[model samples]
Target: MTTTETPGADTVRPRWGAERIGNAIFAAVVFGLGVFALVGAFAIRVPAGQAIGPQVFPFAVAVILLGSGAALVISALRGQVAPREEGEDIDPDAKTDWWTILKLVALLVAVLLLLELLGWWMVAALLFGGVAWTLGAKRPWVAFLVGLVIGIGTQLLFGEGLGLFLPRGAAFDWWYGPGPLFG
Candidate 1:
């Protein structure tokens, strides 16, 4: 309930709580993403003679996102802020680690940049391992191997089993033969 006086102003402004600000931002992002999803869903081309098109799932997801976002915004506006963590391993007094956050961001950026060049299988493995390491994985090599398996497995599942296209970069084209292994 404490208020801070503005410089060169007699009027005082109540400080906005972090929870409220975070909730508002989260709501806005979710709502924006929902709208984007809806737009994208509508833009998808429906093949002739298909009763249920690919847009159906995206539309459903968009509706859910919109509803959840609206609910979150309303709850936040009503001052029903999220509860703080009470974890045993957490230190409440510890300051935010900007460096770790930066590392994670950099890793994600690397993955994005390399996705088309190195393909989903290679880049996804790197991404998964990088994230695991950044989050303090005990055995990074094991994590990397597991991530590699997951990446390759997913590629096979989507590309071969499901007949879905996934990026297979030019660098590994030799291994993939004359035709593209994935879409």
Candidate 2:
């Protein structure tokens, strides 16, 4: 068929372009997140005598999100399209490994479910080791041991140094009094 006589050749252009639609979606998500963060930040109770309160960081993050979202929406309406990305290491045709993804998801769920029962120290170790194994670590035992040390160290750091409480299982309490090692 001739170009001039092609089907729907004189149709009206779409109201919004693909780039605008994508940018609008991105802006909506970002703006929604900003609103959520703002609400959460406002819910935090500011402690007395503190120059910078706990809400400061969250508020700042919310503001940044709001600003960026607005900028994106404005840019989209102005017909500013983003340039396509080009990278050396990216394999455009590579397919995702569903099995590996499912394994990682299962590990995460297991860790979450076991956290209260096994405690942060044990669960964190398992999480690290499990992740390493899922990612094809040759020596899982060594990874587990290293993860165990890191877990214990992190427990001590957060629980003792930062005064943040992490779960300590009943077994741990029975072995080391009512409180865990650093509790």
Candidate 3:
């Protein structure tokens, strides 16, 4: 196939634009991750006399990551990159809402810390409510109620129905008693 090139396209170094630099950095990260995965997979122990050991999946994953990362790095180095998004992109001139971002991040950290003590249900509810409130929900109380329902429902579904080990609240042991509710 005939390949067409613009004037000076055969230059040794492609233009070091922001997009190209970002793409190259991302590609390098992926390549580094692939190397890490491959090395970790080699460290995995294979059980004796097993037809398909645990290492099989890890090795397969490593190969896929390595191949994809190598391809990305090559494409990036060649200055063949892709746009992040297609249509309806965010306005470039618009200022970032740092307050909202900070609140949401704080909420996430709080949830992570309180997950064990307050339980998944309470943490999930708080997280949902906090996020909704931060995002300017019309009714914050209603959002909290909805969050509560969601938390209980998810706990019942994943914890009770699916038999997953979801906490029943360490702080509120009186509410859950000995075993999980409906478990």
Candidate 4:
């Protein structure tokens, strides 16, 4: 068949071309997560006590995700998304920078691992500077300063102001002692 006489020639054109594929993928993931969460709830026992249990929140969130995922998938398949009007000022470079984002995520995971061995201040500092540097921050000193400040500041805020505990790191354990706060 010619391009002009294609099978879907009479249908309305989708306003957002990329959104169709994106929404379908998003829907599948959300639906899968919802199903998993709902299934996980079965492993927990209610214990016949309070109005709700730990499984309640997960179950509810799962249901909502499932419903929304279904709707998004259906809308995407039907091409029912509204089109952007003509001459709209859309940013051409608004797409996801996967490599940068992945680097940042890797930095975050490293920070989490380092937190147990390096302490709150040290890990926080590293996390801050590392993430920034990984994401192409040019100023190393600035990133370091920012990381240090954030790490120490958050440590003080959570440990002192909020009275929440923080790990003192493995170094602290070897130097001072081992405890829940220090461990």
Best by lDDT: 1
Candidate closer to the true structure by lDDT (higher is better), 1 or 4: 1
RMSD of 3: 5.7
| Top model number, TM-score | 1
- Assess every candidate by TM-score: 0.83, 0.62, 0.60, 0.54
Model 2 over residues 1-183: C-alpha lDDT tens digits? 655577765664445876568877898889888999999999999878999977988999999999988888787776566755569987756777899999999999998899878888898889889989999999988889988998899888987778777887655666767544655
| lDDT (Cα) of model 2 | 0.82
Off by over 4 Å in 3: 1-90
Candidate achieving higher TM-score, 1 or 2: 1
- With a 3 Å backbone cut-off (N, CA, C), the pairs that clash in candidate 2 are none
CA RMSD, predictions in order? 7.5, 7.7, 5.7, 7.5
Q: By lDDT, is 2 or 4 better?
A: 2
**For every model in order, what is the number of clashing pairs?**
0, 0, 0, 0
Give lDDT tens digits, candidate 4, residues 1-183: 655567866886566667677777887888888888888877777768768766878788889988987887787777666454455687655777888888888888887788778889888888778777877788977988988888878877877677656876767666755433433
Task: For model 1, name the residue pairs that clash.
Answer: none
> Which of the two candidates, 1 or 2, achieves a greater lDDT against the reference?
1
Compared with the true structure, model 3 gives a TM-score of: 0.60
Cα displacement (angstroms), candidate 4, residue 8, comes to 17
